[model samples]
Target: MAEGAFIRDVASFEGREVEIRGWVYNSRSSGRIHFLILRDGTGFMQAVAVQGQLPDRAFQAAGFAPQEAAVVARGLVRADRRAPGGYELELRDLEVLQGSPGYPLTLKEHGVEFLMDHRHLWIRSPRQHALLRVRAELIAACRDFLDSDGFTLVDAPILTPAAAEGTTTLFEIRYFDRSAYLTQSGQLYNEAAAMAFGKVYCYGPTFRAEKSKTRRHLIEFWMIEPEMAYCDLEQCLEVEERMVSAVVARVVERRRPELAVLGRDVSKLEKIRPPFPRISYDEAVEMLQRAGHSIKWGDDFGAPDESYISQQFDLPVFVLRYPAACKAFYMQPDPARPEVVLGADLLAPEGYGEIIGGGQRIHDLELLQARIREHGLNEANYGWYLDLRRYGSVPHSGFGLGIERTLAWMAGLEHIREAIPFPRLLHRIYP
Candidate 1:
């Protein structure tokens, strides 16, 4: 009947009696002594029940409770170096609210498919819990960095009348009596907002219809896009490196325990600072050729190419000025070399490619209209977009940072699927 306490805060209440309401993570018994590992969402704690320390029924309940059984445990919090989270509870009473006998998941290893099938329950596992916690920390860090850097949060529409990236990767959906598609990126809308607010960002889910089974692709993912009104490519890159460094520093400082749970190499993350190495498209292609890749000048970098390029640097590397032919139509062409656009992709180190893609946008109405027509896109659908340039378009720059890919790289996850909760992939969309 003591005041309820979460395991995460039990350290401050050492020696005080409190009731922990949660599910039994694991249980074991050795004669009269019962050990119950309880997880109350915030953290895990080992609750010990001695036969004579409490009523017979309470001790029996502690011993017999199955894994994941809902329960309330009244106990005195104690410090124990060997226990999980460095805290233990001496149980005075135990009440099993629901017996979860024969839980579907066990201590044994399950196949990826089987685990994916049970992802709803699998997230309760410690590893999944840690990954999700780190993800939350990363998201918060990104928002904090952006907000503190004079960026206003402006929301963009999920249903769009046209594609922001390309038409091929759009997920078309029928609106009432017409057609609409899920948004690929919020960069366009963010540009409009930047004109109004000077500096703005839109954070939301984006959908892509790529049928990729690679470790980096997701059907639905979150993007953090920031646009600045009078920024150029160089200024954009400067903002990007600073924001990335700040976010990485925050995760390293506050999410150390979670990162440790994921077995992340914090040393590399600690080295993520400003002034990341920048290479021109020509330079990157030369490096690839020297490394024996068969890619040509205008070809976009694949996962392998990006990985190879990123691995050459200690910090995230910026590959700048991609060929205008392969980049988005809105990218501003370089004045000295009109063949390339003033855009860049920030490739994460250790083979996590292209976490952030952005660049200076075309502010000339005539050029933008020409580029749209050249790309075989309908100018009618983009009249409003061109109007931004028609009115008073200043030099603007922005980028979209894919949350899943960044988290996967930071957490050292093997697949992007684990970076998100309820991942919607090309083939799987179940619970």
Candidate 2:
């Protein structure tokens, strides 16, 4: 019986015979000599076989078919500088475990729709592997940063009785004769946990039923929500900058090989550090207007406006104190300018817009109630939430960062869809 080993572990088995099980990523034949590239999840390695050197059946099997065909190859590991991993397997035996029938995804270029339609197979590609590797590192970086800062990991509910933010974007379903909606953000729930834990965060999937199809929007995406019990908007922005910088630094440090594979410019990522540029909403609008943009004062900045503003700074631009009319009912109004809310949008460099949206929540019961009424929202739906304010609620602030959007920015990917494995978009939803 052959001892199963991973393709990445083949290096440790140099000059020793080992059995590697994997799907054939690609293969080539040269009359008497054959080369098979195997991918076993961890990584890939090449296996070389000679026609006369192996059994007749093995040689016949080596001449076989398409990419990603499952197979097990028994071979002796040998070091070669020319090979991908500085090593190659000299195949002594080969057998197909399972064969794929005319795989559609080839090494050649594929259309975006075609690739997305075949996402199950697309993840096996070098680019997708690189993106996923970066995603893992980014996630780990986020968790590590929060953990180091004395933040507890608290998981909130995915199915809830009522919507936390707004109902329009929620995906509701019937739950035991009552109505339930998939959570859009865990901020409100995490706020309750924060009162107990002081500082806590929730990282998980959040759903939104957005009807538009944009490069930055996703029907289902992961969000990282960090809530602090006694934090204000300024402190919140500080934590946000530090967390983002830590994630970028860790990704650059640990995933250099993967970044190189993706052809990302690491220098840009290396420049990400603390003290990101900050501007008030009024100032940002002024700057936009100075730059010949026709952006009005109160409206939420569109994609192009965000891109233009972000282009002015090397790091993310923290746009703060947006108009109260445009912000959510929960955001606290700026004391100096009563018309503006103490909310912010963290815009990533190079046109990646609004990776983080957060604010100082209205912790006062009367103010919250008034805002809810002012916004024409159903105050009855938020009775329990209002109770938090009535009973010892302290000043709090938090933010929700869409994981796929952040990953897309960090991985230097063109489309946000490429950052997630099984992306759910408006027009496309399938395997």
Best by lDDT: 1
Across residues 1-431, which tens digit of lDDT does each residue of candidate 2 receive?
Answer: 55678876777888888898888889999878888888888888988888777787887787784588888899888999877788898888998878876899988888998999999989998889989989989999999999999999999999988878764589989999989999988888888888889899999999889796888888999999999989999999999999999999999999998998999999999999999999999999999999998989898888889989988888988999999877788999888889998899999988888899998999999999998888778899898788889888999999988888888888888889999999999988898
For all candidates in order, the CA lDDT equals 0.92, 0.88
Model 2 clashing residue pairs (backbone): none
Q: Name the runs in model 1 displaced over 4 angstroms.
A: none
As for model 1, its CA RMSD to the true structure in angstroms is 1.0
List the candidate 2 regions with Cα displacement exceeding 4 Å: 1-3
Candidate 2 least-lDDT 10 residues: 160-169
Instruction: Please state the error at residue 301 of candidate 2 in Å.
Output: 0.4
Q: How large is the C-alpha RMSD of every model relative to the true structure?
A: 1.0, 1.5
Q: What is the TM-score of each candidate against the true structure?
A: 0.98, 0.96
**How badly does each model clash, as a count of residue pairs?**
0, 0
Candidate 1 lowest-lDDT run of ten: 163-172
